[model samples]
Structure formats: structure tokens, C-alpha cells
Target: MTTAARQPIVNDDMHDIITHVNEGHVPELLHCVKAYTPVQDATHVQMTAVYEDGMELEVTAPAGLSRHFVAYAVPGPAHEAIRGTVGEAMKKLGVKPDSRVAHWCLTENRALTAHFRRLTVNLGEDERADWRPGYACRFDVPGHEHGRPYTLRRVSGTTAEVDVYCHDNTLGSQWAEGLQPGETVTARGDYQEVTPDFSAGPALLLGDETALPTIAALLEGWADEHPVRVLLEVGDAADQRYLDDVHLPAGAHVSWLPRTGGSGTALREVLDALETPPAAVWGALEVSAAKALRKHLRTEYPDADVRVTGYWRVNEKN
Candidate 1:
């Protein structure tokens, strides 16, 4: 790696202050690293190398420890870039990058409805076996160069189930639709748990179909003493059947809204009818609806902890 040495532009007085600051408080040093951009590499480069404009990594393998160099497309922060580069390098070396990368065999794939499909996968007996609620995995499918993320709906021992919505046959959707039993897929994760803090008081959960898995996870940790309310919007009445087998909290009330045309009209109406502000509000929905919900929560219940994430953008191709 080649680093250009440049002198600081600070004058004597400023330099003196900076030196004093550094005497006892040194700024954290970032380790320089590099990662190849996804969907671009066609051929694998040799690991043993030295590049003028790249990062050199010390890799440990079964054979022995060796040095590998991966070039970066652009130069910037090292800490932010190293992990991804290391992950890709590990993949090339046919090794699991970390606990986040797991091998899963597809055990079952069945259509739940015309729009939804239920998939069950058998996991390995490693760190990935300790699956938790609210954790999602990203699938690196064969043809889909850029992976896709899916939330796990259920996990039992070495088995996990994922509910996939297949309304459109995009790259990710197409790969999911054709998945067969015994087929293997790489699952990587940056697990997220966005459930509201119930310790604040009673909670209100609101979202659409995409939020079902997350909502189910939140319900698993539900307490009977605290009141909980769920407001969900679905395409039709058929979509509500999945809730029949779910374990809801005691005193929990669920209201289902069927979308006629508008995005968040039902959610707005539901909020307007609330007798008291909830302790916290959590939701994931379409972009416009999520924005509207955030605005409403900020204006009406300013003191409440509100989280609204836009899962899909309107008329925007991801």
C-alpha cells in the first residue's frame, strides 16, 4: 500500500493546541482495507500480491497464514470497507466469512397462497443454529449477483421457515419461486431487531404484510400485563388467515384494514380514533405511508418513541 505524506495546514498556535489534545487523547486510528465492488469481478486474482493502490490482508487458512491483496474501487475509510472485502475474499477461498455466513439446505417450499410462499430450510449445528426472533438472513442465490434479505418466520432446533411474498418475478423473486428441496443456498446476516421498548408502557404496532414476521417476533416477547394493539393493512381478507394460528398477547386487539386504493388512509383513520397515545409506536410499510405515520406520531405524540421504516418506495426501482 502506498500512502502519500502531506503536512498539516494548521499554523503554530493551532498545531500547539492539536499537539496538547493528542498528548492524552489520541484520535482512533483506522486500519486501511479494500473491497471489490459486487457484480463486477469476473476473474479471481491471486491472493499473494502487493498493489500500489490496494490493501494487504493477513489471512489464516488450514495450510498456513498468508498475505492477500484486494484492490479498492475508491479510497476512503478503512474500517467501513474492510469487512465487506474480507467477506468476499473468504467466499473466494471457500470459507465461511463469519458467524453470519451459514450453509442451509432447502427442506421445504410450498405455496401458502397465490401471493405468498412458505419455505423451510435445515440449518447447520454452528453459530447460525442459535437463531433468534427478529433476525433476518440474506440469500446469495445463483443468478442474483446482488443478494436479497428475508426475515425468518419460525425456527425450531435446526429448522427455520421463511415466508416470501412473490407478487413480482424479479431476480430475487424468481430464484425464490424455483427453489427446490435439497438445494443449498448461502445465508449471510446483519441481524436486526426493531421492536419497540415495552418498558416505556403499552405499545402499538402497525404495518403491512412485510411486517408480519417482525410483528410475530415481537409478540413472542409480549407480556400479558402490558396492553398491545396491532393495526395491519392487507391486500384482501385472505391474507389475514395466517394470524389465526399466531399467539397474541392477552388484551391485544388486532384490526385488519383492506387496501382499496390509497396507501395509508386506513392507518391515518386508525390513529385518529385512538383514545390515548401509546407508550411507543413501531411500524414498517410503504414509503409514503411510513413518512405520513412518522409525521403524525411526531405531531400528536411527541414524547412517545416512534419508529417507522419505509420497506418499499413508490414507483422506484430498487
Candidate 2:
């Protein structure tokens, strides 16, 4: 491989601090370096490295007491490269390929054995479902966030569908956009356990594009006697066409709000303009916006059962 000059992304102040601290234990730290890789998301790439033996270092300042930096080193040039390379290397070293990334507290170095043990234990108990199989049905829903899409899957029995929005701009949209038929993605918890009971009561469904598929599922499953109202925010008329093409239940009241500015802004406008129905309200959108609407519902209609979630954020990678 051709070696290019490695331009450090860290600033002068950061470099000085790292150098000053590393100088004291550079040889030992370098020896402990086991693997490294680059982690790439839609927005950015970050370097995550792991150290075998671990290192101890402290940071000092002119005005206050210094802080300590403790982490394992993964030996690679950049964050993305390190992530890829280290993932492969760890597998060869007999580390479980599905191990979660170690969390580094800014205090002291923790033992690798302990960290790996905890990770292994957690993986055993993790009940998250894989969504990669459903990626084939994923389709972009224009207007809310740039390059974002809605993912869909057919569930057995219950027409009631569940959609998850993780407002951080990382996996949800990226996965939706890149999803192909037969691809698989994992969800880290029991979805059925957390899904609220929607049977009985007037239903007001509010969500962005991400929630569209779920809303459709609910409508399909809902009894004709149940009065359901849907408030959806999309990117444009094209999105409306895509949604309209989906077969929804008969008599389901649907309203579309085109997101002209920010994702949350459109949601706020629609909520303010609409008449509050005496019913159970399911409001899901981007994380920050969902929080805002939940607050509004609490203050404006205290008696309503409001369910809100931040589906995704604009620029977040994960």
C-alpha cells in the first residue's frame, strides 16, 4: 500500500495536550495498541481504536486541575479505516464479532478482560430484533430530512405495525436508503414489550415520514368502528403520491402537511392549527420535535393519552 502523509485532524491545543501526556508513556501505550478502524456514518467518520494492555495518562491546564484520558488504542490511520480493520482483527483474535464497543469513561483505564466480559454478558441477554430482512421494502419519503427514507416490513397476524424513529441521523435513514431485499438489520430490544395497547378509544396518529408505514399498518388493522385520524408530515407532493399509493383502511381520516422548512416546524404548525379530538394521541417525529409536541399536548389537552418519540435527527450519524 502507498503510504500518504497523515495529516492530523486534531488542533494545535489538542496535539500539545496529547503529545505532552503521551511523551511520558508513549512507548508503553504504543506497545499496548492492538487494533484500530474508522467508523463511517452518513455525516461523518470517526476513529475508534482499542489497546490490549491499556494506558494511563492525565491532562493538566494552566487555570484548573487536569483531567485523565483512558482508552484502548486501535491501530489505524483514520477513524473509518480503524473501525474496518479492527473489526476484522478482533474476530481473528477470538473476540466475539458482535461485541459492543467499549465505553471509555474519562477517568481511569479499565481492564480489557472486564470490559469484554460485560460486553459478552450483555449480548447474551440482548433481545433486539433484526430489521435488515425488511430493508427490501424500504423507500425514501421526501421532504422531512434530506436523503432520509421510510422502511417497511410485513408482520404476521396483527395489521398493527410498528415504526421506530431514532432521531439521530445515523442508522435509521441510512439503512432505509441503502436497504435492499434480503438485507438484515438488528434492533436491540423487545419491540412487542414496549408497543402500547391501541385497542379502544378515539385515535389521533401524528408522525413524520418515518411513521408513515406504521400508521398505515395501524389503519389496516383498525376496526371500521374505531375513529382514526392521521396527521402526516412529508417532504412534498411526490411523497403524498407515494403514501396515497399504499392501501389504507377504509374511513381512516388522513391529512398531509408538507414540510417546507424544518422537520419540527411543520409538525408544530399542524398541531397548532388542528382541532384537538377527544382520543388517544400517538405522536412520533424527530426526537427534539417529538419532545416539544409532547409538552404541548400535556399542557393543551391534559386528558389525552399522548405517545411521542423522536424518530431521527437531521445531522446525527447514529
Backbone clash count, each prediction separately: 0, 37
lDDT for each residue of candidate 2 in 98-144, tens digit (9 for 90 to 100): 43221111111112221110001111222333432123222223333
Each prediction's Cα lDDT score? 0.65, 0.44
- Worst ten-residue run, lDDT, model 1? 24-33
272 Cα displacement, candidate 1 (Å): 1.4
What does candidate 1's lDDT look like per residue over 1-318, in tens digits?
322232223332233223322232121101122233222222222222223345443444344544444564445444234334445555554554345678889998987765667889887665645686567778786676658777888888888888776666766668778999999867786456555567787788888887877887788767646688899888867878767668887888898998766666778887878866888888888878887787787678878777776766666654
Q: What are the per-model C-alpha RMSD values against the true structure? A: 12.2, 18.4
What would the TM-scores of all predictions be? Answer: 0.67, 0.45
Span of ten consecutive residues with least summed lDDT in model 2? 114-123
Which residue pairs in model 1 clash with each other? none
**Predicted model with the maximum lDDT:** 1
Model 1 TM-score on a 0 to 1 scale: 0.67
